[model samples]
Target chain A: MHFPISDVTINPIYLICLGFFVGILGGFFGVGGSFLAGPALFAFGVPMNFVVGTDLIHIVGKSIVAARKHWTLGNIDLRLALIMVAGTIAGIQVGVSGIEALKKINRVDWVVGLIAIVVYTSISFFVAWEGWRTSKLPALKSKGKTEDQSAVSKDKMAFRKFTRWIQRIPLHPRVSLPHSGIKSISVWAILGVSFIGGAFSSFLGGGAGYIRMPCMVYLLGIPTHIAVGTDLFEIVVSASVGSFQHALHGNVDILIALIMQTGAAIGAQIGATLTQYFTGPRIRLAFAPLPLLGAGLIIYGLITGHHTR
Target chain B: MSRSRDIKSFLIDLAVYGVLVVAYFILVLQFFGGWLTDLFHNHRLGYAIVAIMLMVTQAAGLEVIAHFVLKLVRPKKP
Candidate 1:
């Protein structure tokens, strides 16, 4: 109940329950559940620094469980995850610097919060529209479960033509990821997307999987299932680096992290397994509103001037 | 699997998980609490490594046990 590392006295049961709930979201959506967990922890009297840093370490643990499950289901593309790690770390630095710059200008909270709201809202609407449009595709609805199953298990995208165009860029150092069904995609594109993901991680807080996962699906042309798995793989590495840095700075409470992870372990397993029952687009559709929820929170904070995290 | 069978398997998994959780709290958290708290104050580098190590090991270890239990409870159909 008393976490001496952060010097916070909190209920262990609350931490466990929160971890379980967030773990489900992380496992199901391939996003760090920090959007919920961060605010909740702050409300429960965990220091903001510990909330952010401890959450990163917690993410690493949960993602490991979820990622392993996805791996067993043949969903991970290791090559893709490895490449993205490099860009992600670099982008985090840039994002951190951006935060400092905004702080100096005395507009850090408003500017950053507004930007996040716009980004989150746009992503929600875009994904919702895309998911809605694609759910109506003739190939999916015409027949019964067979046709629907294929479209669900695999990917069928409304933005296929644009994705194909992005894929056709003749960058010399192209990489082939046959597992993701991406043949000869420019390495630059992968780095660019991951770099943006990393930027969002540091800038917006959490793993920024909400942005990165969709980028993988729409821009890199990866299936939603693969993107979810691969994103978790990427999170395991990036969040480790982040948590370590936060630990060095005395922001992490390992005891708290460990306790939370116990509940997360179960939730992650259930979340990852449940993914197999849904289609790619349906996953995206379900994921759409999470960002909106985040946006609503930011808007609440902006109006009230009562920052949650 | 049928929905009912799936629910039955899930219920069994939850029971097994509940037991493991109690054991973990009694054996691991209770024992390590003092040492980990000492490490947090006196040895941050050690604490950081241990934090990551503990989280990863506990998570992976628990998942393995849970997965095994799940498999036993939900035997594959021929």
Candidate 2:
């Protein structure tokens, strides 16, 4: 039961090196850090709770770097970022509360595991489906299009309807922003997503970007680049708030986080720089499996009675 | 734009190290020693789990501190 530093301590140099690699992958794909870091740490004998908390911090750092990089590229959609933050915060609150409730029944892990599995798998399906659908389209194939434009058009009609449903409600000052070309938003949708994100983040210790980003990009029809940039902005606020909350409750381990962050800080920069060389699909192809594999690892660990103790 | 980014990046990196070092020291004083010992005395699995978790928490704080510092750090090279 005694986890002396000697028992579980990984070489700081190795962790830093790993952090650098994760950072590069994160910058290239815009994820992979949280999704992979948690499981990787778990395998290394880290607890689940700490993994979540630290992952959030890692995300906060990476997002800051990523957002700034994107801003320089003229890729950020400020209006969307603002609205998403509104929803993202609300969602985190609900997520935290839900975990509190679930813990009472001693079923929090199961609930979190279920959500993780569902969200990760759904993402895998969507991305894989997109890849498949694109390959099947004749015009796109012949055009030598690196991407299937059809996916956008086909999804557009559905996304517009969804957005309209979201926009029908009145919850704001009717603020107009040129970035989104709208005077209003479905505050309800934003709130709904925020609530979902909050609960998922609190219980699972990671934001449901699998859900949030897709909702922003496909459901709300925000551009993908903006979605990445804005998501980072929202994470900076929400994850920090969440981390602070956990810290107040004495759930955060400051030392390990510090060391991890040291590496992450350097990693974030490397990631941001690498983003310039990689195309979106190439990045996705290279990095998409990390979370899926992480999810698999967790499930395997659980099913094999890794947590029975 | 690229040159500015590269310059800003180095500044961010420097700031990250500064913040993370400070945060980790605070954590070491607050919980690292006691928590590790408690895990040793009680349930080993629990202790290991906690240790892992704590490491993760430390990592998170480190990441945030790095981010904040990076933001404040000027792009002097640019």
Candidate 3:
């Protein structure tokens, strides 16, 4: 297949299979799947710019499929998603401009790549460690048995208490999320977390869901399913904006995105539906290795300076 | 009877997914083929509008597909 926009000749079947594999992970974990797709596209000889833009274009479509499925399962927190969008928009502007400034300094490629490697590596280790700790705890009852099994455990109680303390910070406008069972949290705190997520996403050229999903659970005390749903919802909006911006810059390869999305659409639905059968800890545990895989790719890219253009 | 219902639901899911894939391809060809390029060449705002339209349509279309699939797969009353 020849992608006109990127002017790359590649196998369409490869992209479709990659999209299906990543779509399943993204749908289940609520990440943009770009962590996998971006490197794979680059390795397939797509330019770095095209990989980022085309991945975002596909992610917008894939997230919609996954998020809609999650919405039907009563997992989405619309209010949280909407609020996060505001912060993300602002953060993306700053991040993009920051990249442009770095470009003028003639070190945008290596700088951003190095930063991504460091951040992804650190976060992957943290997630893996936390997942390991969580898995060591006693197993919960099987799915569909009872809601009581979903309650916070002793080890998690301190983290929940910390979130409660932060939620009590006397901000002017506090909001309650009934769907996620969050009593009250400061609006500013939510924006702060989302802003960081968006900044990292735009700066690193991946969907911020990998960052945001963990924060929503560990920081804001949201349930795993809700975090996943809300993260996908936000990714749909953020990735769309990113795709538009990349299109304006002539970076998006629409043909590639379209081909990939054809597979992702179906895969996403399957992955989202499968999540209903797993417990929260199990899902988080399953998600831990994804970031590690992404970090390994970034580290490889940084070491080899491959596709650093 | 239950086996027959399960088979019917599985068939419905396959059919709906096929429909979704076909609809998505048609929409992509219609909007993205030359229409988007012409719009971008002529006017910047028009290009953005078309892009937004594409996003909105894709989102709505996927949601509709999901809704129909869910409805078809839902268990029937005894």
DockQ of each: 0.59, 0.12, 0.35
lDDT for each residue of candidate 2 in A1-309, tens digit (9 for 90 to 100) = 222432355555655666666766665566646666665655555545545565665565556555666678877777666666677677666666665565456554466666666766666666665666655667654665455355566566668877766666676644444575555666566656656666566556755576677777666556666677767767767777676554433344444554555566566566766667666343454555667876786676456432201
Candidate 1 lDDT at B45 equals 92
On TM-score, who's better, 1 or 2? 1
lDDT of 1 by residue, A68-122 (tens): 7788998889999999998888887776666556645656567666776787788
Q: For residues A273-303, what per-residue lDDT tens digits would candidate 3 score against the true structure?
A: 6676665655666676776676676556555
| Native contact fraction, candidates in order | 0.64, 0.10, 0.22
lDDT of each: 0.75, 0.60, 0.70
Q: CAPRI band of model 1?
A: medium
Write one digit per residue (lDDT tens) for candidate 3, span B22-69: 578667766676766566556655665466556556656766866777
From the highest lDDT down, the ranking of the candidates is 1, 3, 2
Locate the minimum summed-lDDT window of 10 residues in model 2 chain A.
A300-309
Error of 3 at A301 (Å): 5.4
TM-score of chain A of each: 0.76, 0.81, 0.81
lDDT of 2 at B36: 56
